[model samples]
Target: MAAGGSRPEPFVVSSVEKVHRVMSWLKEIFGSQSLPPFEKNSETFDLLYTLAEYSEERERDASVLIEDMKERAAKYDAEAEYLQSILTETFDLSPSVLSEEGSAHLKTLVDTAMILDTKDTSLASLFSAISDRSLELLAAETKNKELELNLLEVRNKLTATLALENQLRMDLKKAEKDLEVEEAKAHFRLQNLQFLKHKSEDISIRIKSAEEKLIAIGLQESLMHEPLMKLSQKLAEVQEETVQVKKKLECYFNLPTSLPLARVKIEEAKRELNALEEKVSMRIEEMTDDFLELERL
Candidate 1:
């Protein structure tokens, strides 16, 4: 203590003192409410104390502002009462004294003032200008609405027309496709008809050539069909009968004595020969009738 005779600071704040000061500030701000627990360190105490000081300063400023506002409000109220008394005594202006029309006009003026964003309703010229401007604005709005409706209708019609155009385009495409298919079918049928016509002409030429050849051989063209067929069948049957007769003659020549059995077999053969002769005569008669009919034709 005697080396340099330096003295320690007299009003040094401990962490506990700072914490107490913070608690007192909190009580003043919050009406003595229980404070929440917090860490009791030097840093914590210092921070809390700084915050408490700031809050106390703000509270003081707010209280001063409130007092000034109350004084102004009291002054304004007194002025309003004085003005009301003057209005009643000098102009006789009151709810009972004002006519309904005057009240309505006053309300209109007040509303006009509000719309114009001003408190001055003493300018008659300003109210007239505002009323004219409002009328113009209303007319403009109505015209704009009508134009919008017309535009909407035009758009709807355009949409419908576009849709119809698309449908027609599709139908046209389909029709073109159908026409192409039909044209192809017609072309194919034309080709088939031409081929058939050519084939028929070739067959006719062949038939004509065949008829010419038959005429050169001195045969009637009519003999080439039914009559020729009948003659060929009859010639075949005669050849078969001749072969059977040769076979019977050979059997008769090769017979060993057995005359009685040979006679019985010969009788059966004779009956078969008679039957074949009768059939041949009938065929000849039929051929003669056919030849006569052909001559007549």
Candidate 2:
């Protein structure tokens, strides 16, 4: 309507296109039949917008959770490595001759010498000192054997604790992967809902503009043009049908509304995991104490 310019094209709605395609396809497959109104289609777009926002928030929360788990996992991994290094440094867990065996051989030699020393008073005092030294060495050897056994017990407990920690780490990794998948799904759904809302707005505007044009033309002529009237009626029908189809499709593809449930479950899991981590920490501390005692011995 302006000089040297093209007139704006009539706004075509995607909802109308969707209805036309669905109706035509259905009609071809089956006979023409009346379809019921889908209430959700007539429902306000606010619901979709709200759901989109909720999904976005959930996605954000999941991302945060994933980051937190990664941080915790890294921390625990370092701690486990440190504990392992401490264990290796503190305990000499290699195969070697036991002190008891060597001490037994030394005791036999000392006993033979004691019998020989009884033949002369000159070696009597020297034999007494040797006897005392031999007894002291035997006592030290017995104490060393006990300490070795204790160290063995502590090492066994630490190994078991480390295994449990590794299992927890694996579980956390699986949970992280699951959260990532859920986040992707939520993001996809959010985009789809937003798109639908936008299409609905565009369709509504087009319907209003068409209706106004029809009304003006009919008023000016004091009678509706038959073809225009038919077209208007068809458009109205298409609009309604589109809404119903949209609702039905939405219902068919309903996204699972288990975000809150999942959150609750994840929180419960986190609490349990935290408790297990604390237990492992306590065990590590105990092992550290034992290692310190072994050093003193």
Candidate 3:
């Protein structure tokens, strides 16, 4: 507000090094041998504070004021020294004269000592304040370092966890792909088995139908063979009848005989037809058995 137009206040950061430096300087400042005051330019460096003990005005050159105070203290010291020298050197004086007439010089000596004592007390109080600030600063620094280390550890753990999570994601994807492949194979195998079963059923049905048809055809052939055998027997009997008629015609008209072996030849033809009929019956039975087997299949 005074010079920088209301800039935000700077944070007060104290350290042991700064505290030690201030203490040493304070010791020098308050020492009896040295000066009580070494103030700085207010325009260059801000004042330590605006306490009533220091001054009423806030904007003033502290260095000049402190120099003036030091000069006054030096003058008081010189007067006190000079008074002691006078007391030691000059002895021809009455007690009333020394007490009354030298009262002003005695007062100067007492005031100087009081100022020195006050400065020593002030320096000691300031040292206590510096020590407190130093310890607080050290504690703050340690806490900050601990917090930083904790954050680093947490960050590292998070990074490792992320890596592990990514690996798990990849593994999950692989498992999904494997599951898909197995599912496809299962589907294919199921369809193939279904097709084979259907094909087997179709083939079995066709074989049964073919066997049934073949058996029916064989049975029909057996029936036709019996009729064919009867026809052959009839033909042989007709031939014998024809020979007898021819012999009768020949004997009635006085012709020669020509029907000697007609009956024997008819009997031989009948035996051959019976043998063919038995063979046909056997073939029909074989076909019927084959048809039953096809039905079982």
Candidate 4:
């Protein structure tokens, strides 16, 4: 202070100022309601320093008091260590932040971020993609459902068709059975007709042989053919009786007897020389019974 041409004692802390500063510090620390305002800065740190310079605790430098405390240790000297604790609580010096270069890039991106026109462009694209995917899924599901329905329909149709085919097969089997019965009956009748034809042929051969015998016995010329005339008359009577029996059979059976009788001849030149005896006649008894049964039928 003397080298700078200033009075050292006047500039130094005075007794009254020190007292005033200490009072101010006390007010800051304990809150003295009776203390008045100070002339200058009324901060607690300023007051404490001013008071310390004049008090017995004075040292050459504040560093000597601070010593190893470094941060606000002096503020907690007479108190419950509250102010120093608050100072330490407010700061965090842990090295947990990202690198400086990464922070700068992130800051630039944040500062230049785009916040316009995206409502129209980005939302439209997202909505279109979503709609397309939804439509595709819907179509695929519909197709699968339709295929299932078609499969069910096809199965139903197949079942119906099989049922119909089975019914037709049953009908065909019944018809075939009926047809077989009819064929058997028809074949039996055909064999009967052929047998009748063979019997007629045998009867004709026998009659021819008898007529030859009668001719050898002079039955044709002697007595002016009396035996031949009688034989012819008898043949005529037999033919008349056969016609009547045929008519009875035809009338009763509602059939045309002409079909069976058309092959038989009634003319003298054709049928006059009959030979079979009445007892040996094959057609007599059976033909008579057949005519009677036909009339009843």
Candidate 5:
């Protein structure tokens, strides 16, 4: 079973070999210690195969980039040699014999020619003037950026101010509505106060007229209230006392009619007493006979 397990199918063996090659390549790129143990399965083999193909593609791209850089370097080297020859032949000075100041001046002139897209070193003065214009343009651009920033800040502040103004307007409207409601309530209350005042004045007028009429009839004002009230209280007290006296008189008048009923009740009580006395004598004679029989025994 171990031998059979160790041996895999032909396709699996081929896939395993391919995965091993990919693993070796990966180890070269990212050291063996960085990679995990290779898994022997169809899925793992497929993944390793795909990774190998992708790595080859990236390697090809890197080779092309390296070639391009090498070409550029070679071209730059040739240009440098040509420039050195020109300096040695035309100026009778090798690059090694040129002074630091002259070298710096030549480099600046070359840089300026490159910037202006021209090969004319004679236009150095024009390049200087153009450089000044570029400096001014850069300064203008920087100032423009600052102005844009300030404008943005101002716009943000204006937006906030507008929002606050809108909120204040809404609050003002709400306050106005509340004020109107309060004013309406106050007006209603004032009208009610005025109505009450008029009603009280009318009542006062009616009371004054009634008092005048009473005076014209020769009746004293004090007699209309306090004296009448006192008379009414006295009359109620006299009526209560009369009712008590009448009750006592009625009880005395009913006594003659109740006497015959009282005498008949007394006669019925005497007859009940005589019947009780005869029943007691009969119970005593029966008890004496029972006692004499017991003595004879």
Candidate 6:
């Protein structure tokens, strides 16, 4: 970028003023025809001409440096934007948002390029001014690197959160599968108990018939007593099994409640990720607009 704008030559103006003042002084000292010889004063006029040329050359050099600076600033800005676009594409961000973020980093360089030594129109001052702009560019470049590192950090964080989200989802699915298996087991146990209860009722009827037969035929009572006692004990065991099955089924039925909590955590994570993305986008947009204005300067 240009260090400064073109300015009126100070030497040229002062030289003219000096010549006018000398003539006025000479006219006061001597009448027009009796003025000092031209040969005696030629050297002074030569010096004035030299000063004018020197001033012109200095101004031209400053102008050229300023133009060169402007070109360099523009090229750097373009390259910064191009690199930002590539990074955005690789990272899966909106182009406008990333582009603006990149431009924000170049704002300082752009502003520095627009600096001009219009007021102090001297080579030394112009050079100093250009040097200051170079310093500003260096600082801006440093800040740009910092910004890139920060962006990378954010991307890494996002990636980690996404991975966590996937893991959570897989856990939820596994939980669901486990609950289903428990439910199926509970259902089978309940069915088995009901079938056993039906069989026990039939055994009770057979034991009653065996008792009537034994009384009519005068058979020993011990045989009837053993079978009846065994049938009663089996019936008691089936009832106990039914109770245990109900308890297990109830426990499995409550498993679904935990699922909702797990799902809620995943949803919370998703919301956080979305909010982060929105914040980044909004900040980039604002910075981009501000930087663009600075570039125009």
Which candidate number has the best TM-score? 5
Clashing pairs in 5: none
**Stretches of candidate 4 above 4 Å error?**
1-137, 221-297
Higher-lDDT candidate among 4 and 6? 6
lDDT of 4 by residue, 47-145 (tens): 566565455355445557578454434432533244335535665222235468766864554333322212122456546655767798899999999
Tell me the tens digit of each residue's lDDT in model 5 across 20-48. Answer: 88778778878746876666778877787
Q: Which window of ten consecutive residues has the lowest lDDT sum in model 4?
A: 112-121
- lDDT of candidate 4 vs native? 0.59
- lDDT against the true structure, each candidate: 0.79, 0.63, 0.62, 0.59, 0.73, 0.68
Predicted model with the maximum lDDT: 1
User: Model 4: what TM-score?
Assistant: 0.28
Q: Which regions of candidate 1 are displaced past 4 Å?
A: 1-125, 224-297
Model 4 Cα shift for residue 81 (angstroms): 38
124-151 per-residue lDDT for model 3 (tens digits): 6446655767798899999999999999
Ranking by TM-score: 5, 6, 1, 3, 2, 4
Candidate 5: list runs displaced more than 4 Å.
Answer: 1-22, 37-52, 109-297
For every candidate in turn, the CA RMSD to the true structure comes to: 25.0, 58.9, 28.5, 36.9, 29.6, 43.1
lDDT of 1 by residue, 133-155 (tens): 89999999999999999999999
Number of clashes in model 6? 9
Pull out the clashing pairs in model 3: 39-63
Q: Tell me the tens digit of each residue's lDDT in model 6 across 197-284.
A: 9999999999789778766776545335665466457546755655565554454454554698756655665565566557556655
Rank list by lDDT: 1, 5, 6, 2, 3, 4
| lDDT score of residue 15 within candidate 6 | 50
